[model samples]
Target chain A: MASAPAQADLRTRLQNFIPKLVLAPSVAVIFLFVYGFIIFTLYLSFTDSRILPSYNLVGFENYSKLFRLSHWTTSITNLAIFASLYIGISTLIGLALATFLDQKIRGEGLLRPIYLYPMALSFIVTGTAWKWLLDPGIGLEHTMHLWGWESFQFGWIKNSDYAIYTVVLAAVWQSSGFVMAMFLAGLRGIDNEILKAAQMDGASNFQMYRRIILPQLRPAFLSAFVILSHLAVKSYDLVIALTGGGPGRATELPATFMYSYTFTRNQMGIGASSAVIMLMTIAAIMVPYLYAELREKK
Target chain B: MTLIKQLKLSAAVLALTATTAAAADVEVLHWWTSGGEAAALNVLKGDLESQNIGWMDMPVAGGGGEAAMTVLRARVTSGNAPTAVQMLGFDIQDWAKEGALANLNDVASEGGWDAVVPAALQRFSKYEDQWVAAPVNVHSVNWVWANKKLFDDNNISVPTTWEEFEAAMQTLQDAGVTPIAQGGQPWQEATLFDSVVMATGGPEFYQKALIDLDPEALGSDTMKQAFDRLGVIRENVDDNFSGRDWNLATAMVINGEAGMQIMGDWAKGEFVAAGQVPDEDFLCFRFPGTQDQVMFNADQFAMFDQGGTVSEEQAALASAIMSPSFQAAFNVVKGSVPARTDVPDTDFDACGKKGMADLAQAAEADMLFGSLAQGHGAPASIKNAYYDVVTAFFNGSFDSETATEELVTAIEIAQ
Candidate 1:
């Protein structure tokens, strides 16, 4: 017991190693399942695969074919429109709700759950509910006609130019709630003394938000953008359930395109290439953001 | 050590799977989850259950069966393939090429399938001169189901030619009726487009462009003319004909809201479920100018290989699928003709009789080509390419000429 310093250092070393050992299993799983499949997908992209994976390598043949496809180009254009509107509008609505709820208002507890309810439902559920509600013959349009408003119509889901926006509508509706919850947490976490101090410094309510509160909520905004963008990139079930990428490929996303090509279209190579490209796009956005966050914590 | 490891793994697998992975449970993957379709499937399920074979239903519901196909791929790649998969057309052949399908040679030989099943179906049933799938029922997509009351009330005679069909559509349109109930789903649009192509240029053209992938035929004026006719048909559709299900379109025709629907024989199941009589409630005719041709798609169950130890239950299931009585019973409910040419039409209704007659005549006349929209005539890539071009054309994104150009380019690239 008295042989103290060396023995104590050994104990500390064992404590550090125990935590790493506990983390090892999960780190190994992530490396194999997530990154390993990614690498497999990259390998499959270079081959002449069809309904099944074939190892007959044709190099960049699949990538070139993917580029030449009008459908692929259409899907990319749709993603651009979808991702922007999805992120921008979700952030705005989320921030607004959070800020409103941040007010010292009555029944804030009841209002918060109602706002956060949509996030509990899966995108598939959201897509199906919205599809029925948006269909012209069945939903609002039919109801309007029944109510003697014969000219009223909301058939944007069936229109190619507008169908992508409908997807954005559903995506934003489902996700804005979660973003609001995050912003709300951030708003609550702000030091109350800062607001008091701002008021004492002659800052108006607007000025208080502009100077003190908004800046403090930067982390929430960053998290919201990152989460929503990742969701946007990998959106498949919603597109499948809502429109099946139809009305002439109007709302086709890269995820749907990849599945269709790989499984149904017998263009597995091109599908794999599209999947790889999607992974790269996500990594490009996420890698820097993740690194910065970790570095800041350090 | 390796031997011991292998033996241990085998023992664990045997222990775990001993209860349910018994030889008789035929795990059949299919996409028939609709009411009438499920009812028809029940007939098969009951038949198998009676034969002491268990039926494991793996229903992945999407009309196109793409979701089920994805599931099948993942299962097969992971070495957990089902006993059988409900596949059709080139899809079966595609799976067969990957060496996943079982050779149903014993069942085919015992059942005399080659003698009873139609040659057109046999083209898909076999790969490398060995039976890989058992043909179940034949579905023709060249039928036009008309609202009998509406047509009769308007004095619209049964149209058997393009001119008459146009006159009928125009008459219905002029009378404030939606002429044709068409869905804007890509496959539905492609279905309409395929019918137009066949109606305009006949089966030979369909075979060349869709089946053979002849670039000349794809880009030719015949293809262009087909697109032109498609444009004319597009005009007859209602304003809200986009993104609707095929059954809903059939419902429109059923309720007299729409004059006619161009769909496969399976649409008859919808009419039947609605309690409509064949010729009394709805009349059937070939898509105009396609009277000589029957655009066909057949559903078959391709059994998975058990590494040369094919089970008796699998063989029995294949034989049962091809049996004349089961075929007749299944097809009667399924709204398709039996794949076996020998199955009598006594149980069939008027529309069914007409389908059988047209199928017979088309078979004799050598005009019974498989359907492109139904994944029969070509692989999915080429089929989807055709769908893209045709749908874009139908949606007014492309004219006849540009549609032709794009169609050629797409098929060439896909092929």
Candidate 2:
């Protein structure tokens, strides 16, 4: 009687808790492996360590060392220049492509994949292909010579002062298509009546785009900017594959410097300290922009 | 009756399994991806197989060995170190100090390594006088590789001195061909700078500046002359030389687009890969002025201590690495001289013979410099300081005077 009812209640509670029990292992795994390691890296930057991890407390020596090295300063400076140029150019180019595609043009569906194909390939493969294409004696220069233009030179990739720009160009080629897709989605989501009214008012093409469309695409720009900035801050594989931080360290970036310090030089403490500085620098740049975006959304 | 029969059968199976255990499986990680390097590795694979050892081959293809190092570090940190890793120079010491290496003194003693291997190589292969790694091959870094046909066509003989070499480069430049085929990466640049230092300053100055971290030597007039020569090299290179791979630079020489390349003996492997015979298609010479000085490093294997079931197997693998037969076979295919001095030179090619002869002479004269490649010969801070000054000079950011001042500053900071 009363015991039967209590037993039924116990069964209901067990049934209700099964989903949580099933999800516990995965949740705990993600937390421990992903988040735990990040915290550990953060903790290591505060200590002075060398070839192996050390627990000895030596506050800010590694950070000061990071500031002292010319390579570190150059790396941070180059990262900023690369990020700004890459993101700004990519967003503009992506917007233009999205707008052109929205005109009900021929081959729109077929051409979408053509532009996006570069994003599918790994950075290493991208770098190899671009290196050949940009090489002086091999690709473009050879092609020009064949066409009887013997004096033509497209050797920016070989110039120390201009090598980093080539990396930026390769990055833009790979990422602009991704930005275009996002912009295209936003363009498609716009209300049809607003555009119709704008046209009805006999508004000029440029004016209509500037006043109505660009303002509405603020969220898309923010999304693309954040993604590009994140990619730029962590840039390593492409630089390594393409230039290898040379023409005499002309194209060296923070990520590559950190890698060389940690593994190649066996200065784990200095490497971690550089990584911490990079994180702080990124935070300083992104936090205000992120906060404004969140507030605007609210 | 059935239960008794089953129990007897199980006992018999257990007894049979206990009599024989499976052969130990060893996984080796390396960065030898070129055709010639691949051929060289196969020789080692065959030798390992003959010893009843199973090899797990993990090859990462990049000449600079960057990608391979990254993957290795990740595996090691995660407690999954390979049985052996093909390492160069200072990297062995760096890894050993982290308590990851298996001490190989017993194996070294059994193989009589002390009698055959050079004392300079021992600095890198040993930590605290205990053999923590096995040296397989020695690679000399200051070799000048040239296209014999191109030189002959241009009516040029092999230059015997630095001044003559400069004149030859000028002649090649006048003929509208690139005089030097330089890959514009950092390590390649470093290689060129080191060769220049050897050519201009001789072995003693090189030892003082690179190995001893002597600030006074770095700021000397001899170092300034080296920088001036590098400036000449920079002017001679084709406009599109930046970011090129060393092998690709070798390809240019093979195709007759360039006349010469200053690189390590490993360039011989590249030449061989392209189906070019040593004395027929190309010639290997010591960079003219540095003919008496040999700057060398050894490729060695450091075994990591993997606990549990693989412990005994790891020790056996380490022992097998130091065996005389393995060393001879591995080095011959690698296009490098064996670490042991007593190995027969019968299997070596013309270039290998020349290398052996030069190595012998340099050793006898006490003109051999250990390395800046493997961190054992010089401290990392000092090496990087040199790299900074040398790289800046190569890029034309600093002139000879500025470079000399910077070199002094670099050494001061390093000390």
True contacts kept of each: 0.62, 0.50
Top model number, DockQ: 1
What tens digits encode model 2's per-residue C-alpha lDDT throughout B1-415? 9999999999998877643332366778898887778888887777767878777889987654656777888898887888888887777887877778887777778778888888878888888887888887888888889999889888989898888998999989988889999886666777778888878888788888877867788889998998999999988888777667788898899889999998888888888878889889999998888878888878788787655333555667666666667666766667788777887777788999888887888888888886563343565655666677777678766789988887786556444
All candidates: TM-score:
0.93, 0.87
lDDT of 2 by residue, A148-180 (tens): 999998877777778889889998999989999
Residue A27 lDDT, candidate 2, scale 0-100: 95
The alpha-carbon deviation from the true structure for residue B158 of candidate 2, after best TM-score superposition, in angstroms, is 3.5
Candidate 2 lDDT score relative to the true structure: 0.80
**Model 1, B175-242: lDDT tens per residue?**
99999999777888888787888888777788888889899998999999988988999999987787
Write model 1 residue lDDT over A101-196, tens digit each, in one string. Answer: 988899999999998999999989999999998889788899999999999989888777788888999999999889999999999999999999
lDDT leader: 1
C-alpha positional error of residue A276 in candidate 1 after TM-score superposition, expressed in Å: 1.6
CA-lDDT, candidates in order: 0.88, 0.80
Runs in model 1 lying further than 4 Å from the true structure: A1-13, A288-298, B1-21
- The per-residue C-alpha lDDT of model 2 at residue B347 equals 76
What shift in Å separates residue B236 of candidate 2 from its native position after superposition? Answer: 2.4
